[model samples]
Target: MNPAGDPFLEACSKTFEDQFSPLEVAGIGSFGIVFSATTKSKSHIDKLGTPQHRDASEGSGTQALQAVKLCLPGCPSGIKGSTSRLQAEIEAMRRVSKNTTPSVRHLFAELYAFNTSNEPWYSMEFILPGVTLQQVFDVASAASYPFPEEIVFHVADQAARAFQYLHDQCRFVCTDISQSNMMLRYPGKEVSVMPDLVLIDWSFWAEASDQTTTCAVRNLYNCLAPVFFDAGWRCSRRHDRDSCAASGVFHSC
Candidate 1:
């Protein structure tokens, strides 16, 4: 329960660990804490002299914006052991990255799995210039603010694309698709046509399996009832993850 004495931090010492400087707390999940970090590779640090004095450009590159997630055992997100679930997520991320087309792959972040002192964790891209759909909905509803129909259409299109890529291409289902699990890129911007959205929270994102049907139904309820309905939109799609695969579709793209 101690922050400073946490296993993830304790395991991370030298070996690229020093490269990551945690700037602030991102959010807390049932089992872990996330940090928005400024990270440089070992070579990047050597070139910059001090990791502390790294300029904005240093963190502006490919590995610049990253999210560090430290796992806690038996988190509510996992039905099996936390370690097993963490490994599964790493696999899922890779599948999406390697199996999908470049345009579709760019819509999601890359994941890297690391372990130190027998403690395992992963770091991923921190999607920014955006806010969680949950936060957006809660605040707007409280203020009785109604977003334009244009924004809704944008959101709908982007979400459909992301979900299709996951289901048909990645062969994974976002079994939990609540507002918090979705984000709208570039929040507060007036320009809206195709809503730039990204799906977050891989905890319940699983490969298409026998249990996908139940998960899909539950996910539809969690996602549809509150946000879409409140926004005066209706969306429904049948969940058939298994059948959606391999219509002359190779696992590899």
Candidate 2:
């Protein structure tokens, strides 16, 4: 808990009704506030949701708890229009989810409700118990940990599989495949990490099926597909290849 008169928390809390409290500022940018919450809705019985850990005896004990996410448009500084972008993202998720497989949580924009009557806002599922691979990498990198081939391969494999689905099946080229966009739905259960990884954030993507044009530029060291440097070149499946071998670090925003 913060101080009683914490203006930041108070301002954020006022954004939502009394039911859902702002648990924490998950991600803060010029866009808006991303909060993890516990809802006050009745009949919220605890059902056997997705498992995050696997039972040791059965060699499976990585089942995680459940959670909810609230996306508020506009940050404290009011630099960007989160409301409009939120709508676009939700619409994109809806269209993509219909064709995506259950294993790939690519289209997980399950909107619980919205409050457009007054101001625009976004409320959706809160995938819990599991964390993002970005978080895992942060911990390892912060400790100056060296990567084992198995771990690197495992993470890359999971991401690559999701990317394949997004490109091949969904026919969408996700220009932003950073660690922050990769979320874990269920952890150590019977589900393999390969498919459990949910690729999120389509703000910098191009949906070839829809023929949408994207002017977003992404040249980050980590998720930089070769075509990012091709100025004015549209995002397509052909650019995802790694044309050169470069050794460095990748960071997620």
lDDT, candidate 2, 1-253, per-residue tens: 4514745455556755555555665666444456665544432212312232112112332222223323443464452366655566666566566676656553243333444344535545445445665675566556655544433434444555555566577666665556576665554222454324555455456675433312211223344222122212222355433441121222121
Q: In order, what lDDT does every prediction score?
A: 0.56, 0.46
Clashing pairs in 1: 154-195
Q: Choose the strongest candidate by lDDT.
A: 1
Evaluate model 2: give its TM-score.
Answer: 0.60
Q: What is the lDDT of residue 188 in candidate 2?
A: 25
* lDDT score, candidate 1: 0.56
